[model samples]
Target: MTGIALPSLPAEVVDQAIDWSIKLTYNRADASTMTAFDAWLASHEQHRQAWERVQSLGGRFAGMPAELALQTLEKLPEARLRRRQMIKLLSLFAAVGVGGMGAREVTPWQRLLADHSTQVGERGRWTLIDGSVLDLNTDSAVVLRFDESQREVELLRGELHLISGADAGSPGKRPLRVATAFGLFEALGTRFSVRLDQHGCRLGVSEGAVRLTPRDGTARVAQAGESWSLSAREATRGTATPQEVAAWRDGLLVARDMPLAEVLAELGRYRHGHIGCDPQISTRPISGNFNLTDIDATLDFLAQAHGLRLNYLTRYWLRVSV
Candidate 1:
């Protein structure tokens, strides 16, 4: 048996193709639709590749929870929100333009608008159209767009905390939603946080209830003090410890017998520099509450209290030694 080969497309072209799909789906595509689309796909072999790349963009909508995506997408402001975003992008272009560097610097908002991402150690916060708030942890990114019928937020990277609010005018409308790497978390007027890691994703509910439905079909309900880790195929339930989860918001680092490697990973989120532990020492247990504002002091305390030594490869790279 032979496996079918998938087509490869350039990412930029793929993004443009998805933008075209959004325009077409929203009735923003002009009468030159077919002509323009055909010309676009015919421009080069890569153009066709790009079109094929985006052909599956709407696959999530097939048999998708319409009510959920609708509510989520509707929370985003109008397209006019792009104006401010574009201005930011223009500044980057101007800087590159002045520097005479042909290379372009892509802003987080542009990649975010086009369904891209943020690099390591970057955090962002955004307000939804319905007055809901979203906070993206370090290295996080999300895509948002609102239509007359819905509000939607698609997590592209890292973790995001969402606080859903009551619909200002439409009292009986569907609830907002957040889509992550592992599954969909439908916010029912609640406060929740979802984190995506290399292993999979974790969801922790702070208040109210959230429906956790896997992209593959299985579903579970998570309430306050509950947490679950989900992969594409399964979900495992765990107890939610709010102090551990919310510690970041308070500028503190709290861990409970977590592995040294994992502790370092969390610490990395608070600083612009790098921190890691020796692989042999990674399995060592770590437990403590350290202030994030002074990471050097935190590291110093770890060495004094835990019999560990901190080594700096460079100002930005750190590692733990025994």
Candidate 2:
């Protein structure tokens, strides 16, 4: 048996080539349509080497269920998945050359959403078309889709802070809407924070107003400097100051005599691990401002001031005890 000789490609160049090839494959291409691609490839030895590295990138799709692959790829950590795909493709290219070119078709939305999730402990700020801005907190995921009729954002997971944009040109433009686990929040040209926690959903209005309609019949209107929680049964509204609601944006978590357990829950969102109060300390009162960026220092401060002890089982797990 005769084996095809493959050219040596630098690791970086090979990676770029595989990425481009995967993109092209998803865009739709087959083995026989390589006339122009071959010409382009031969234009430079580097290009040829790159193409060689990328041609076999889709072997993972072989005999693998397309739906499973798509879902698995979507859930895998982006960096690690991409690296593995690149390595697989490069290996095939080195073994079989450009003759192997069977790649699965993945939709653009799947690719886009798969690429846009936030990293752990990382927050992001983005601007919308209507001039309003959005701040995504750590470990959050959102999908933005705009059309001629309306602008919509789907909160797939995690939390987001939205500042509604005023009507720019169209007087009766469709109102900006945010969909989440709690329900749908319709902004009345308002600024608010929407968070999804294990228990339920929380909304804190900073400026303007917001209308909350739950999956159930319960509904409520939240005004400036107000907060609300929506659950499966009902919506609860309360008066909360703007400073307290917006504190996280400035890298601080401020609690005003809140229960120790609740404060630990909020702090856990900004950290990589489980942060919980000891059963004995669950009812303790927690106050003062804690830095969101430095969880360790904040924990240390809590220990020094309140006689709480910081305990760590792993880098990703934390607990507070007597």
Candidate 3:
């Protein structure tokens, strides 16, 4: 349920709730402790309600990799959590999703209510009102803002493969732009793909050209067959093959001597939880065509091909080691 649906309880009840959470999570509660907790719960309806909220707060940890989840929770400000853990409970009143609670992701309202969005391990497409086709890759969000003046798409996260459509009424008069946190991608009759993450945005142009204007006010042009690494201030040109650019769209990952760590990171995009690489073998070069939709097959392939080991800490946590 949304936070608005949950009523507020007293501060003391909330404190007890957090205390119970820490004890149960970090300590083995003896029979006496359980008995005491039960009696406490029975003593006041607010206590029971607060305990329920505490449990619900952990709901976001469900299905998360054990280590990743624990690490994220550990990153929570210790003093802040101890003092206001109840309010910090994502289920209680956090406006953002669990992603923001501790995982450090930004889920803006624009992305939350985007015209087109997809979850992890999901791929989808949408035909905009003006007939443009947008293919969204896993864990992606894109918002389309089209009006009488222009056609605009804002990519909040993940990646997008866009095929611009003509403005049937007056194609010449309509201008199209794709905006990211760092800058703008102005379409010049092009087909392009864009991926965004903590580092910045990676853009590949397949046909025609794109003019990018970074937040720092520098402008650069990327033509066909060229890829650009765009950060907040500038765009650097690079090489990209069509197959390399379009592989994920066809449910495949194309690696051309990419680092094992890089490959694992790319594959992690399609799988939930953590796909970790041992520091010992992360620099190993890996090159192959891998299926994107079958994560198990990919993992199996990695193990068999590279003589690596897959250690499953939990269904949600995996460690690849040599």
Best by TM-score: 3
Q: Which parts of model 1 have CA positions greater than 4 angstroms off?
A: 1-124
* Strongest candidate by lDDT: 3
lDDT of 1: 0.61
TM-score-better candidate, 2 vs 3: 3
Alpha-carbon local distance difference test for all models: 0.61, 0.64, 0.71
lDDT of 1 by residue, 26-53 (tens): 3312223433554565467876555443
Question: Looking at candidate 1, what is the lDDT of residue 122?
Answer: 50
Query: Poorest 10 consecutive residues of model 1 by lDDT?
Result: 97-106
Each prediction's TM-score versus the true structure:
0.61, 0.61, 0.69
From the highest lDDT down, the ranking of the candidates is 3, 2, 1
